[model samples]
Target: MIPYVREIQFEYGACDQVSPLIRRVVANNPGPFTYLGTGTYIIGKGEVAVIDPGPDMPDHLEALLAALEGETVTHILVTHHHTDHSPLARPLQEKTGAKIYGCAVGAKAGDSAVITEAGHDLDFSPDIDICGGGAVFEGPGWTLEAIATPGHTSNHICFALKEENALFSGDHIMGWSTTVVSPPDGDMTAYMDSLDKVKARGFDILWPTHGPPVRDVAPFIEAYIAHRRAREAQVLKALADGHGRIKDMIPTLYAEVDKRLWPAAARSVLGHMIDLVRRGIVVTDAPEPGLDSDYRLAG
Candidate 1:
């Protein structure tokens, strides 16, 4: 198992026959080229299912294939089509004869994928679609359920292992920084709904696509929900304080937010602002403007 930044180590197939699965750190396109993601491998019944194949890195792909040796990869499950999480689906499929699966929907216009803020392009059109909330993959002693959790991306899905009682929470929950809710592609309402959906379900271990696995899920979910609510309140406060456009609100709203990530921070703020407008918490001249528009909280 290779060790990378943030004390993350690849434990080959520790979860199943696919023991010692590597966590290859690929370059995140947006801001500072930081490393993110924990690609998982589940080898069973002479077939393998690799989740979130991660970015299109030749070395990373090679590492995955090398780890597999002669194992046959049956499916490549994507949590979302985010560039960092799912870009390698095609290539990995090509090499392993694995089928790619993600949300049935296609890309939407004006989505954050167009911005290219991250050096990596997250835009994708899946080969196989898994729309339903629960799709099962049974093998050996495990049954994996694909649970649709749309919020960070419209097509995001989390996988749950019935036998282990673990949920492979893609970006829906991460150990590192908070997941970004970029507009159009990311919906705050759906995000909150999805979080509730997962929280309602009983699960012990959370195998997030990024960062380490969360052993204590209930508290984590509560903290995540509270954090989001707090962020919304902060956004509202910034607007009430006379901060207008997303750009203007960034400095005060995310004062301690990383400067290099201000662009992403702005996108998340836009998502909140849009939600606030729909809820009548904020007033705007035009519902959805191209750019540079003022926003103020409703009196």
Candidate 2:
């Protein structure tokens, strides 16, 4: 089968108007992983707010500034600390004199800890680290309330747009591809819980950072949760049927997938393995099960 496909039709450097209050500028960093680069969302009217400022690239920053030429960027909010998701917050903050806000970066390590997706900006310190809900940013005919949906990463946040009844779903729930749950930064348990948290919320549509907007919110979320459960069940069966290592188990689980994506697929399998280990259903040869660790069902 082919590798993971991205359905969103986007061109880098084009600021397309998605709605009455939202204008999206796609960055020139598209790849197998990033899809059609990063979508830097310009929200609100005259005085607007930017979400997920994208990479701190020269052209992307210029595009963002040019998008808000006459308007002032009052605030900049990022969903998480990933390079593609953030990094430009600092530059934009300096250019527009807006305060940057996001969750704290995952703790840095020296190669001893479990692997996570790389290139997190540790220097990003927000003037006000929004503690998810209870805080609201009100603009002209719009209201943005932070949703604490920490699944992709520990500090990920999805902003709920009150006026449109939509959500600025960052990497947490992208319409293009499933969010990668890489441990120890990503927790399958927390990821599943956050999906439930989002399901319980009231939102009509989702404007994800990577791909197109998900209009079918309820069914999409339900399918996402069900897919994860099925994956977990498959992992359990792999262990029960004498397959242990992630290398061996991925083929059985993702045989329809292309071989090139197995590495990324393995990371996701590791997430399930870690979740199983935590729940006392699986055990690994290594005390801390990383990408290369061997796993088996618990006695």
Candidate 3:
């Protein structure tokens, strides 16, 4: 089981210093997907770099600006173009003259793909594209290296803080719950590969945008990888046992999950189906493997 950090101590609209180089202000937008809301991080001291400016709430904007009263925001770094994570970036930039940096919008943006719980920020295009990873951004006393991790979204990126040995993980990995891999953009194969990639980096800690930091790095990541592999095995077994459609397998596969979240679970299952088909382990009749498509064991 993933060691989920369900409770965090912080008031809405208040900035709290979580580390020597990081101060976070949590946005007040909480929901089923967003644990306590978006934790917009300010890295460094004098000239700071903001990671994930969060939703465009007027109150949140005011609170964030208030927290950085005398400091200069040199770079506004986005993890992805999700509405909840990056909508406030442009507005913050307009106020601070900070350059926005992150991955480009997914090529499948505005397509017929199923919209996940958190929607896309179609209007967001980063001033600097750090999607391919290995791009470094530094301020007064901190340096952040962007690492591409696409699964939760095609363009998701994580920022590694060299000074703190921590990674600002967006939705790629969360401490509250598993990330929803909605597709046409979210890919299970890519997600698994990205998980392995992050694990190999061996960061000391992970500070996800929506939850508290993941302090036990290695074991936590191992659990995530194991959970996904186990889920795929269960999905394959369901297909072999005559559960061809995604909806048909949900009742048993996600028996512990709330009914309201079944839709998101179905999308994750579809991601696995697409990956299975690509691996020649499964076959589907639709032009692309999707939630409604019938999947069967490859002959």
TM-scores vs. true structure, each candidate: 0.85, 0.92, 0.98
C-alpha lDDT of residue 38 in model 1:
43
Residue 184 in model 1: shift from native, Å? 1.1
Best by TM-score: 3
| Predicted candidate 3 versus true structure: per-residue lDDT over 1-299, tens digit per residue | 88877678999999999999999999999887887899999998889999999999999999999999999999999998888999999999989999999989867966656676778888999998988999999888799999999998899999999998899999999998999998888888889999999999999999999988899999999999989989999999998899899999999999998787899899999889989999999998899887888889999
Better of 2 and 3 by lDDT: 3
- TM-score for candidate 3, please give it: 0.98
**Considering every candidate listed, which one attains the maximal lDDT?**
3
Stretches of model 2 off by over 4 angstroms after superposition: 1-9, 108-118, 258-260
> On residues 1-299, what C-alpha lDDT tens digit does candidate 1 reach at each position?
11111445544222323223222332233233233444555535456677888778776677677766677777788887666777778888888886788875445624544353433344565677786767787655557789999888778899887767778888787755677877677788889899899999979877766656677778878888888888899877777777777787777767876787778777777777778888888888875732377887788
Model 3 alpha-carbon miss at residue 176, Å: 0.8
How many clashes would you count in candidate 3? 0
Give candidate 2's whole-model lDDT: 0.81
Higher-lDDT candidate of 1 and 3 = 3
Pick out the ten consecutive residues of candidate 1 with the lowest summed lDDT.
18-27
lDDT of 2 by residue, 1-63 (tens): 112335776667878899988999999987655767889998887988899999879999998
Global CA lDDT of candidate 3, please? Answer: 0.91
